[model samples]
Target: MNAQIALMLGQDGVTSGAIYALLAISIILVFSVTRILLVPQGEFVTFSALTMAAMQGGRPVRLGVLVLGLALAALVMDVVADRQRYRAWIWPKTSLALVAVGLVVVGLGLSVPFDRLGMLAQIAFTLATVVPLGPLIYRVFFQPIAAAPSLVLLMVAIAVHVALIGGGLLIFGPEGARTEPFSDAVIELGPAMIASQTLWVIGVSALLTIALGLFFEVSLWGKALRAAAFNRLGAELVGISPEFAGRTSMTLAALIGAVSGIVVAPITTIYYDSGFLISLKGFVGAIIGAMSSFSVAALGALLVGQTESFSTFWASTYKEIIVFTLLLPVLLWRSLRQGSVEDDE
Candidate 1:
């Protein structure tokens, strides 16, 4: 290929890689803290994208109900847990607050109208509709079995994935949508022009990654998460709550997934099932990193992105096969190098 063609391809690859890197990090975060593979991570992406698209089109985004409903369920669970601790009134108070939030969201959705809102407000609404589901899902599905073995957690994650797929189908229907671009501006490179959204993808991904690093290195909550990830039992012994780690990790994962969705949606059509494939690509990168090393996983995801882009240019029909093929050697090499280890008694 000529130099200009190569530059274009590189740009596309880096843009796509930014999203994959975010997904890889989100997957790694959830897996590291909770030991669950978090296969349904993609659904969050799809849901968030569709939610934004719906809002942009002036449809009453019903996602507010989703967020509130899940919150209510978690509140109920909390109330159940707290009653035995002599805080029986916690349930009623939290339930009232949840009900108020749900009603406000519903009312605002009906009265304000999405098209009338500014872009910033629309983005805020989208975030409000997607981010809380993370902690709610964690509370409902995973918290009770927080101490379960990795195998059990993986099984449960698979179940959650299937459930979320169906939930996505119901929520979004079978149609696909591409939202309006965050910015239609273009930037001139040496030989090729790049969309501003590409910069958005790369810039936001880099910032979030750096922020996450700083969080772990500098913040109290980050230290708690790092401690839990390194040794759960030890973290617990030192008063780091496992539930807190699980909830926080899931929240961060959802945030990453939502942002990835919103950022990429304008570039391509997104449907209910789109998330699975996106998450799978990220998982391939995760596997390449042995699913634990953050830097390696990010690099692997960038490699996957570049491989997919170049492969598409060479043979569009075989692009996916070519991209997926890259995972085999990495898996084999890791398998051979590590062999197998027996669990300690």
Candidate 2:
């Protein structure tokens, strides 16, 4: 390949890699804080992308209905799980809050002219609609089984991933979509040109990464989450609530996933079921990190992105196989390094 082509491919790799890094970090955060592998994390990406595409196309966005329905289901779960606390005339504050947010989202989706809205408005609206699903899903699916074994949690995550795919099909239909670019500008370097959107992806990803690092290093709640990840029992004994940490981590995951979707949507077409493959790539990065170190996972994801990009150039038909094959050696090495243990469950 020529130098120009190689540079362009490298740019694509970095752009896609930034998004993968975000997903990897989100997966790591959720796994660390909650011990649940977030298989459906990619749904947030697809849903946000498709929703934005619909908005830009002047089509009505029906995501609010989902928000409302999931909110109601979560409320019911809350009541059923804690009958004594919710027996009074007043509803639980958390349930009421989510329901109210759902109603507001529904109202906005119905009342606003999304097509006429500015880019910022559409992005904000999209985030508002999709980000809440994370916490609601947590409350409905994972919260009840907080103490369950890892295998059970993984199975549940797989189920949720499947269900979300079906839900995506129902909500977004079977068609693929791409959104309008945030900008039409391009930058020319001696021999290569870069799309403005690629810069957007990389810039936003870096900012979010720095923000998260600061949050964990400087913020009290972030420290609490770290503490919980380090020692759940000790954190609870020290007055940190595991439930709060889980919900918070889920919220952050949703935000990261949604933003990733929004940023990358313009660069590629997204289908309802596309998230699984994207998230699976991110999972490879997470596994490379051994699911522990955030920096390692992000770096690994960048390598995955570069590998996938270059593989497509050389063996387009087998790019996926090439990307996935990376997991085998890493997994084998980890397995060999660790001692076997009995399952208490």
Candidate 3:
């Protein structure tokens, strides 16, 4: 490829890699805290993108109904079950407030004219609609098995992912969507021109990364999560609820996925299930870091994007093959280094 083409490819790859870095961080965070793989993390991406698309198209967004139904069910479940243990927990009460807020947002989304809603408002609506699905999943599905073996939790995560894929098709239909550009300007520097949207992607990723750093290093809740991840039983002994840690981690993962989706939707046609492949790429990047180091995972994700971008030019049909194949050597190296540990379960 020539210089211009290389620059364009680099730009595209870097933008996509930035998004992948967000996903990698999310995967690592959830895994660290909960020991659950959180496979459906990607579905939130599709959910946010398509739901936003539906609202922007002036259609009655169905998420309002869905969220309300889920809220009622969760309430009933809480009422019927050992609410004696859960009734006073702050997270449950906080979740209820968030659901109430989401209901209001979605209600407005369905009623307001699409043109009347500004771009940021639409984004906020989408965020509200999609982010709750995370904690809800943790509460309804994963929390019950929180003490299960890692392998069992992994199975639960896979099952959750499969269910969400089917549900996504039903909710969003098979059609794909692309959002209006967040920016349309291009900056020319010598022969290489960069889209402003790319700059937005990179800038937002940097800001979020820094924010996450601060939150983890400085915030009490962040420290709580870290403590939980390091030693769950110990955290619980210290009055830190594992359920709370898992729920919070899942919520943050959902937030990251939703934002990544919103940023990426404008750049590509996002189908009901588009998140699977994107998340798979992120997972591969996460694995490259041995799922432990944020900086390393970010670097691996950028490399994944760059490799895919260049490989598509060289062998379009085999680009995925090339991209995925990079994981093998990395995995082998990790396995050799870490050896194996048998699960007590």
Candidate 4:
């Protein structure tokens, strides 16, 4: 391939890589803090994209309905599981807040002139409609089994992924959707012209990554999350609530997923089931880090993106296989290095 073609391919790689990096970081954050593989995180991406597309088309936004339903179920689960700890008259605070947020989002979806609204407003509405599903999901499904074995947690995560896929089908139907580009501007660098959407993706991903780093380093809640991720029992001993940490990390994951979806939607059509493969690509990056190091995972995701892009150019039919095959050597090296140990349990 010529230099211009290579440059264009590189641009595509960086754009898609930025999205994958966000997903990889989210996966690592959730896994470190909660030990639950967030297999369903991609649903947040698909749902957010579809929701934005629906708003742009002035169609009914069913995501609000899903959020409301999840909120109600989370509330019931919280009350039933923890009723002995609080007074019967007092509602579980988190669940109550989720329910309130759900109501507001639902109301907005039904009443707002989404088609007439500015792009920023639609993006905000999409975030509001999709982000809460993260914590609500954690509260309803994973919270009760927080102390379960890692294998059990993984199984539960897979189950949740399946459920969300069904929910996506019901909410978004069969059609694929894409949104308008965030900007029409393009940048010229030497022989190559870069799309504005590519810049948006890279800029937003970088900003979020820096913001997250600052949060972990400077904010109290971020410190708490760090503590929980580092050592759950120790964090609990020091008065950091594990539940709060789990929910917070899940919230961050959802926010990342939603933003990734919004940013990428204009560039690619997204269907209800599209998130699985997209997220699976990110999972490969997480594996490259052994699901522990954020920076490593981000870099690994970038590599995956570049590899996928070039593979698509060369052998379109086997691009996925080429991308996934990257995991084998990394896994083999890690396994050989660490060997196996019997479970203490």
How high is each candidate's TM-score?
0.93, 0.96, 0.93, 0.97
Off by over 4 Å in 1: 84-103, 343-345
RMSD of each: 2.2, 1.6, 2.2, 1.4
Model 3 off-target regions past 4 Å? 84-92, 340-345
lDDT of 1: 0.85
lDDT of each: 0.85, 0.92, 0.84, 0.93
Highest lDDT: give the candidate number.
4
User: lDDT per residue, candidate 3, 182-203, as tens digits?
Assistant: 9899899899888788888899
Q: Could you give me the TM-score of model 2 versus the true structure? A: 0.96
What would the per-residue lDDT of candidate 4 be over residues 21-69, giving only the tens digit for each residue? Answer: 9999999999999999999989999999999999998887878988999
Shift in Å, residue 70, candidate 2: 1.0
> Rank order by TM-score, top first?
4, 2, 3, 1
Error of 2 at 44 (Å): 0.4
For 253-329, candidate 1 gives per-residue lDDT tens digits of: 99999888888888999998899899999998888888899899999999999999999999999999999999899
Which of 1 and 4 is the better model by lDDT? 4
Q: After superposition, how far is residue 209 of candidate 1 from its true place, in Å?
A: 0.8
- Rank by lDDT, highest first: 4, 2, 1, 3
